[model samples]
Target: MIRAYRNHPYHGRSPLPQTVVAGWLGITQAQLSRVENGPPLVHLDRLTHWATLLKIPESQLWFSLPSRTPTNRTQQIAVDLLAGAPQGIGLSGGSPTTLKATAHEGGGTTDRRQFTALAALAGFGGNSLFDALMLADRKAEVVGMEHVRLASSLVERFRQADAALGADELCDVAMGVHTRLSTWAARSQYSPGLGEALQSALADLANQVAWLAIDGERRQQARPYLNDAITRARIADDPREEVRALACLSLLVREDHPSESLHCAEAALRASRGWATARLRTLLRLRTAHAYAQLNDVGGFDREMTKARHEFDHGPHEDDLPFLQFVTAQELTGIQGLSYLALGRPARAAESFRAISSGPRAGHRRNQVYYTVRLAEAEYRCGDIHSAAQTGLRALPEVRAISSGRTMRHFAQVKSRLDRERSASAREFVDAHGRAFQR
Candidate 1:
């Protein structure tokens, strides 16, 4: 660990003596010697104090500790966490040399102890770090848009940890930071990279919050965030991100505002042409189909679905962005199925749904719930009352857990259709799940 510290650029240029550091920290020379040479417990306060005096971020101090050998269990755990970080969450593990350089660039004195702690926790497979960062960000002392942005990104990583994980707090923190950053960015002079960073952060936060609101049965609440995301994406001048935001808005508007949904989706496709990767193009196409189906445009939906299918059939390479890489054929099939159902093509919808439901990729519970519900709706439309009821039953737990208003609206639509036929099972399912829509 000592060698690692020495090699760090922050430490390499004009290394501070132990005695000098100890004096600055107001600690005795002998005590500083113990801290440097033995199994000494570095108090958090003292660590932060020394970091300030050394003009290095506290994160650098923690990450650059001489005792952080690969053999050290804690340090090894930290390294492992950095190794497997998800995309959009920022850098995880890199070469030690690279980390040292980055720390130097970010101004060694910024105290990101909480980020280090959260990263370490994520590496160790603990979710509590997610909560910790959210809590810390709420405190008054934790200002600085960059720090808040980092915390928000960490929360998003935690959300993507698993489908079942609740990201309410994460979303809330992200929204708060997004609001604050937008205000600051509006007033600040133009900085080369600053505007882009602020725009990206705001867009990401809006997306996260919109997702959470959608999950929590708050479609009305979700709409503004989705719109805000679109604004930020446009400011960033990244058509792919802009289209992604529009896609989200399309989903929100599909039921009641089909024409608007179609407009957003088509605009997304047009804006994203050539600028986006294949995966993004696939998503845009899928969304366009959904919008067309909502407008009862079967021909348009079919054309878009065909294009989307072709794109998904060609799997993304490993080098693709991690976020986009997860958009698989199975997922595309599910979306295609929903589009068919919306277009009143029960047979085609069932075929698409069956293809997805029969796959081994059903491990994704969130997708399973979404697809199952769509299948149930399609079965009802096809007059397969028994199958529809059974599928709805299987999807009930997920629906209740997720409690999305849009999902409940879909459920209600299916239930109303089934009710006309006096299907007892459908009635029961509605009785149990319909209350979510009231909120």
Candidate 2:
């Protein structure tokens, strides 16, 4: 495939240089050569990324890409709702398309592009009809397992979208979904089982919304959302949702309230004792490790980090929760690197950050940008000023594209540090992209 791309007719009579493909793949030229001459790539995410990057037809690929198809009845309903269903066919006897038109009829108008983006962010594409169904004046009806399933899917998609696109249209869309689900679970009639399920889905949605708020640097807003998630999770008797929310709470409060963060992490671990998958345990352990790092407990941090890495490597089985998809080995390494930096172990941190390869860059745009900035920080702290500048440069384009305040804040910190250096490369790179680092 690489060879074919290199030899495409657009390159004129000769093949495009390996250096060009290497730059495109963000790998070294030798690495590209080895990949071209090496054994076939087997990793699913890696292959999917390459296929998407190269615009390969799905029919030609050996493995399936990240599927956009609605997987169940609930998903189909959700997709239809987002895509603006035909007039007068929905539960409220109103058309989603009509609702969108009506909403635009008044002097107020929404950005059509944002609507398209929200739909696509939630793993569908087209204008959204969610406004009609989610309006405050809309009558609430009894929700069943299917409604709960739809909410669950929306939460999962919101997480996935945040991973790929960061939190622009995502946070607002997720909040809308949360409001609708909360209304259904609170005021609408349902069987006890359905009610519990709805509450659980709402818990997950609230957690997702809190995460988006955190990503957007709205930490104050995140606290109440996460607290609400915990309450809802407990009401639903769902350990998974409770633990997930608790983990987010741990991260959110780790810096100012390390002890509280530690408490949250421990509580989450305890909640997951019997039922958690290896991935879930790994995440909880990482949260515990982060708390330990914050509190300067080197021994506790090291112990938990060891356990987290071991468990993360052991399994990501079919039983793992859908949200655990982001808990990759690459992300684990990045977190460890960041924690190492927090502990003043920049040399070790640089080593861990350097270990993250380009294989996971496709679907993880936000993480890649964020981790690259951290890697730059580690290098800067280790006194490799030029290397740090170059690493920071690599993240610049992506930083512009993503909407992560947290990542941008860290980037600004590292850039400020790099700017103080006398090195020519550091000064030039810092000055060149100074506008991006501006608040």
Candidate 3:
């Protein structure tokens, strides 16, 4: 891991010298070498701090860090129940390094699948984060555009953090931010203009939180947040926010309800027309294409994909929304590959997926896992067993590092396919990662 970080492109094309790497890690090169070559470093605090500094995926670590659940886990759950707290509510410690959707008291099952921050405030008792937010709210008499601007900045930070850390470490934090923002909107005094801005920001935050939930595979928990975003967007008369929330909703539902997802895509497209940038329109079109692919409407899928690519080729403009900045050519290529795979065009999908490499998308862990899984699946479908097995193996590190249900699903699909094939490499891959892939 230390050597890999030294070779990471963020440093340069060539590996950095040991001294340089050590400097970045705030250690002497000798100490760094000893740590790497010496007996396994048993110091937990140093390990955790270095992992967090290097942004290593938690799943990739050799040992577990401290659990994020309350110290008295069973007691916490019991208190919630006795207090009549809504079912499936959970809390996260404020530290980014420790952020995670903890398991409930006794069970090994993680709470992300069942718990969410929908009623997060119910668990706020004696929490410093809650207290800090409450103090900030009390100190502020008037809400203004400045607060909205600050929140908008925070939303971007949240998005960046989500991309780097995945939903496991980010969803609860984002949910807390959304909760505080919601409280501020309701409780603070502001002019009509400022109020609309605040609500728009809140809507944007809700959309982010909803995305995090979706990424975490907390779909049921995500629904109400998306709906709330839509309501806030409408109240603020912000069509862009509405389009974003609707587009995300479409993505969340595409696998289960293609028709409903199509409706959401269409509604978002209608709202985005005339005002939205070409990139925004492209994203909406691609989302529509996904719904078509899910419905097995090849013609509809091809048509929308064609339009999406055409719009994408139109390039960036100054009017592009800030949130749409991630809608890059790489993202489009990857999505096109996914749609093609869904449409039963594995050959075409493989070709498209091949265009996505870690070059430009480096440091974006979620994208790496997602695209790698998609590529491996496409390869497996194309009957390139060796390539598929190798690709799947390559993604294992990142797969273990992050918590993304969507990525896990694709990865498991490929793994299952490989298992059935029973090729030597396939069997080896399965056997090697059996524990990690276990539910």
TM-score of 2: 0.72
The number of clashing residue pairs in each candidate reads 9, 0, 0
Best by lDDT: 2
Model 1 per-residue lDDT tens digits across residues 50-97 = 555456754654323222122233222222223222111112343111
**Tens digits of per-residue lDDT for model 3, 43-62:** 23335555765667878865
Off by over 4 Å in 3: 1-146, 358-363, 435-439
Instruction: Rate residue 74 of model 1 by lDDT.
Output: 27
Q: Scored by CA lDDT, what does every candidate get?
A: 0.57, 0.71, 0.69
The full ranking of all candidates by lDDT, starting with the best, is: 2, 3, 1
User: Model 3: how far is 335 from its true place, Å?
Assistant: 1.6
Using Cα atoms with residue i matched to residue i, what is each candidate's TM-score against the true structure?
0.61, 0.72, 0.67
Residue 143 of model 2 has an lDDT of 63
Q: After superposition, how far is residue 251 of candidate 1 from its true place, in Å?
A: 2.2
2 or 3, which is superior by lDDT?
Answer: 2
Worst 10 residues of 3 by lDDT: 78-87
In Å, residue 360's CA in model 1 sits off its true spot by 1.7
Better model by TM-score: candidate 1 vs candidate 2: 2
Off by over 4 Å in 2: 1-112, 126-137, 357-362, 435-439
